[model samples]
Target: MRTYALTVFSQTGEKLLDESFEAPSNEEAKKIGQARLDETGYSEYTHRCVSPEAKLVLFHR
Candidate 1:
């Protein structure tokens, strides 16, 4: 499994959420990240999910 970081930010660049999760692939990471965002009611917020290598798996502005 690979480590992924999921972060959510406010419009003013304030850090809202910063979490780490594991997934077998980037695609899976994206789904997990989105789910977490939705659960936290941050789905429409600025956010990004990045792999261990710093590749962006998901992003929204």
Candidate 2:
């Protein structure tokens, strides 16, 4: 398994949110990010692959 940091960006290109966690693959990482958006009332937020690591992301966006 690997940890990945996801950057959720708004339509205008401004970063809306970010998160990191351990997952079996990048697909799981994306699901983790989607779940976060759903929980935060931003279910429609678009996400992009910023980077991957075994470290936790400090900032939310």
Candidate 3:
């Protein structure tokens, strides 16, 4: 599996998610990120991250 530092920003430009994860692929990384975002109660807001698309990170928290 690959690692990823997941992050998300709310529609209002507020940071709603910040986390690190290890997943096999971008889809899995996104799943992990979305799960965290949902926990923060930003499920209804449009969100994105510094990275346009998920990728495998060599290291993560």
Candidate 4:
């Protein structure tokens, strides 16, 4: 597993939230991030996942 930082961004490009944790893979990290976003009821925004090993790893837009 690796540590990933999840960043939520507004539609206008402002940072909304940041969370860091571990996931087995980038795909799993994205799934977890999307699930987190689903609870927020804000779809207009986008998200990205970053890790020391993966860099700018995942993007859901």
Considering every candidate listed, which one attains the maximal TM-score? 1
lDDT per residue (tens digit) for residues 11-61 in model 2: 798877666667776666667766776787766666554336544332243
Whose TM-score is higher: candidate 3's or candidate 4's?
A: 4
Give the whole-model CA lDDT for all candidates, comma-separated.
0.96, 0.61, 0.57, 0.77
Between the candidate structures 2 and 3, which one is better when assessed by TM-score?
2
Clash pairs (backbone) in predicted model 4 = none
Off by over 4 Å in 2: 49-61
Question: Which candidate, 1 or 2, has the higher TM-score?
Answer: 1
Q: For candidate 3, which ten residues in a row score worst on lDDT?
A: 52-61
* Candidate 4 structure quality by residue, lDDT tens digits, 1-61: 8899878888788889888878898778777766777777544478777876767776778
Q: Please give, for residues 1-61, the per-residue lDDT of candidate 1 as tens digits.
A: 9999999999999999999999999999999999999999999999999999999999999
In model 1, the runs with Cα more than 4 Å from the true position are: none
Ranking by lDDT: 1, 4, 2, 3
Residue-level lDDT tens digits of model 3 in 1-61: 7656755565567766666667677666667766766688765665543233443322222
Q: Evaluated with lDDT, which candidate comes out highest?
A: 1
